[model samples]
Target: MEFEMIIMNLLNYSGEARSYSMEAIQFAKDGEVEKAKKSIEEAEQKISLAHKFQTSLIHSEAQGEKLSISLLLIHAEDHLMNAITIKDMATEFVDLYVRMSKISNGGC
Candidate 1:
């Protein structure tokens, strides 16, 4: 794939991951446990796709390939980072919600 296309894919996957993470949180808030779990799974898949593209770039650089550093590339990296952060936080939030539900229901 072309460099630009790779970067675009990174952006797309990251954005999708972020969106799914948000959906997970929303589902959890609505007490849809299964849907929340599914959303988190989807988010993870998207993050994995983004990480695959990122690994290719890292390997290329390790092999002495110097890629041009463009503003779009920087933006893409920022998006990926934010998506990862959101996914992490969303997982925590989902867990918290589940715990709260169990507590309210008097479950150990």
Candidate 2:
């Protein structure tokens, strides 16, 4: 695969992950726990795909393949990092919402 295409794939997957994570949090806020969980699972799968692309780039660099640091590559990395951060926060938010629901229902 071309380097630029790999980066674009990573960006696409990361963007999907970010979007799913956001949707998961919104679902949680709306008290749709199952939908939120499903969204999180989908987001995780996308993140895994993105991570595979990232690992390939790292392996290529380790094999002495010199990759040009292009603006698009940097933007792709930003998307990946942002997606990771948002996923983490979304997970926490979902958990908090779940707990709040439980408390409100007198479960705990």
Candidate 3:
């Protein structure tokens, strides 16, 4: 498989994960806890796919062959970092919904 393809795939996976995470927060805000949880699960799965690709790169580097970097790889890394950050924040937001649900009795 070409490195460019790998990188593009990584970016797609990362973006998908980030989108799902955001959706989870939206669902929670809309008072859909179950849907929120499902979103999180989907996000987790997406992240796992990204992680697998990341591990592949790391493993290749650790084995003493540096993977040649390209603009696509950089773009993918950017997406992966942003996605992870957004996902973390989304998780916190979702947790807050749990507390809010307690106070509002899931009315909102």
Candidate 4:
């Protein structure tokens, strides 16, 4: 596969993951635990797809093959990192929302 194709896939997956993570946090803020869980699941799926692309490159490199680096490749990696950071932060924010909900319901 071409490097451009890989980078496009990475960007797509990262965008999907980031959107879902944001939705998950919004759901939590709205006091919808089930919906938040579903959104988080969707986010995880996207992240998994991104990981697949990353692993393919790593596997090829491990076989002494070269993966060309380009501007798009670097941008895709940047997007992936941002998505991952957002995902982690979203999880924490969701947890905090749950705690707040519990407290409001008098059982925190």
Q: Write the per-residue lDDT of candidate 4 for residues 6-85, one digit (tens) a residue.
A: 78999999999999999999999999988988888888899999989987888988999987888888899998999999
Error of 4 at 65 (Å): 1.9
Candidate 1 wrong stretches, greater than 4 Å:
none
lDDT of each: 0.95, 0.96, 0.87, 0.90
Candidate 2 segments whose C-alpha is farther than 4 A from its true place:
none
lDDT tens digits by residue: candidate 2, 26-93: 99999999999999999999999999999999999999999999999999999999999999999999
> What is the C-alpha lDDT profile of model 1 across 1-108, one tens digit per residue?
899999999999999999999999999999998899999999999999999999899999999999999999999999999999999999999999999999999995
- Rank by TM-score, descending? 2, 1, 4, 3
Candidate 3 lDDT by residue in tens digits, 1-63? 566777877998999999999999999999898898898888888988998888888888899
Q: How many collisions per candidate?
A: 0, 0, 0, 0
Is candidate 2 or 4 superior in TM-score? Answer: 2
> Which residue pairs show backbone clashes in model 3?
none
TM-score, structure 2 vs. true: 0.97
Which TM-score value belongs to model 1? Answer: 0.96
Query: Candidate 1 vs candidate 3: which has greater lDDT?
Result: 1
lDDT of 3: 0.87
